[model samples]
Target: MSAIGTRAGTGAAGWVLADSWTMTRRELAHWARQPVRIVVGLAFPVMLLLMFTYLVGGGRGVDGDHAEFLVPGMLALTMAFGLEATMLAVTQDLTKGVIDRFRAMPMFSGSVLVGRSVADMLQSVAALAVMTGVGYAVGWRWHNGLTAALGAVGLLLLLRFAMLWTGIQLAMVAGRPEMVQAVQILVWPVGFLSNVFAAPESMPGRLGAVVEWNPMSATVTAVRGLFGNPGGSGGSWAAAHAELLAVAWPVALIAVFFPLAVRRFARIGG
Candidate 1:
């Protein structure tokens, strides 16, 4: 009986793992079918990189190459900006009764959300690769070597992971596909209010202070440090401890939103 029970538990765990992988493949298959989305996503950030580097020109108070500062900042912004796509996908699935169909089936609970996040993270990696390639092509170089570059990329993806769950939770709460645009509008302020495009020292005293404390700022600053880029002034505790905050901010976001997303995902049918 003991051996049978152990085997049964192992089989159940395997079933859950299989279900999660199947769901992840379903989302990946969508990417193969809709290649434009991947291209458009890659193009938008590269466009921003070009426009800002050329049109907006270099940032004030920046040290060394401006592209150095802009590239890392753009990478961080890229991570934050893509949440709308995930939210739209979630809401669309909910609204079209696809989620209902899954809920009715004998699948592993929470596998859908898991799968969505997995596919989105993979897409995030592809976006990061494209952005890094563009950065190199446009004269941005990582002076700190490969390990640091990889670490910087890891932090950016950590931000993306947090944003993924946050978007998922919001989409689940919003309940309809139409709410995508509204949630998207809210995302803009969060993205713009950060120290992505300029130095905190360059802005007004109070607004600069707020921007310094922004979560996106932490990740960008940390990445700049890892890449040996220059932009941070580093007077405030937030600026001085950017790497710490970069990890803390995203971990806190995941801590709060991951459970909320999972709970909310499970609650949709009830």
Candidate 2:
């Protein structure tokens, strides 16, 4: 009855928004049937936090308190670790023909990936909240004010969004559900090769430079600064400009992989 609805239906941007929301709802409905997956995803990072903080011992080159250094790093790592969900979801859908159904529906072309990104980001937010509570219980308080803390959370989610697209593209390339398991082996090295558990300075000469330059390390350092956490300072330019790289790295990644994933999905959809 309204021109607004008719206008929305007539535009590219509006179609994408409308279709993405519909697909987002589809993902939310799936969540009810996959409660165990969400729980495991959230719990896996917590287990890592507990293991490193207590059983494994303290982080190297962590100044002031190790737990403070740990909490921020773990937050960044937790955001990244959830990429498996995106990877598995994409690969499984590709194999099971779920994506084909969506493509056949006359929906907006990018809506499928957009919806998946939305669902994953929401799941990541819940995981972050759980992680924050666990951090507080472990005596990891943010010395920064509330605004800064919020900024830290924003940066954390931004990195996850970038990683989501990267994971989607990687999963598409792998082309099967079972290949995801092998692909997962790469996540561990990518997670650890950065400055997550240990400071770059503590790593050693050239290796430390590589660690400092890792895109994940940039976010960790940026968030650490925003949260007023410890041990983010570095001798290298990349580490020094963590704030800039935190923004740049994710933007660059999305630019590269977002289109790649869309094109790859097009192949299957046809």
**Which predicted model would earn the best TM-score?**
1
lDDT of 2 by residue, 90-134 (tens): 887767756667777667867888888999999999989999998
Best by lDDT: 1
Residue 14 in model 2: shift from native, Å?
3.5
Report RMSD for candidate 1.
3.8
Task: Extract clashing residue pairs from model 1.
Answer: none
Show where candidate 2 strays beyond 4 Å: 1-13, 58-64
Candidate 1: residue 266 Cα off by (Å): 1.1
Clashes of each: 0, 0
Candidate 1 lDDT over 1-270, as tens digits, reads 445442344577788898899999999999899999889878999999988886676444433377887899999999998789789888887777577789987778789988999999998999899988988887899999999989999999999999999889989889888888998888888888888887889889999999999999999999999999888675999999999999999999999999988887787767
Model 1 / residue 150 / CA error / Å: 0.9
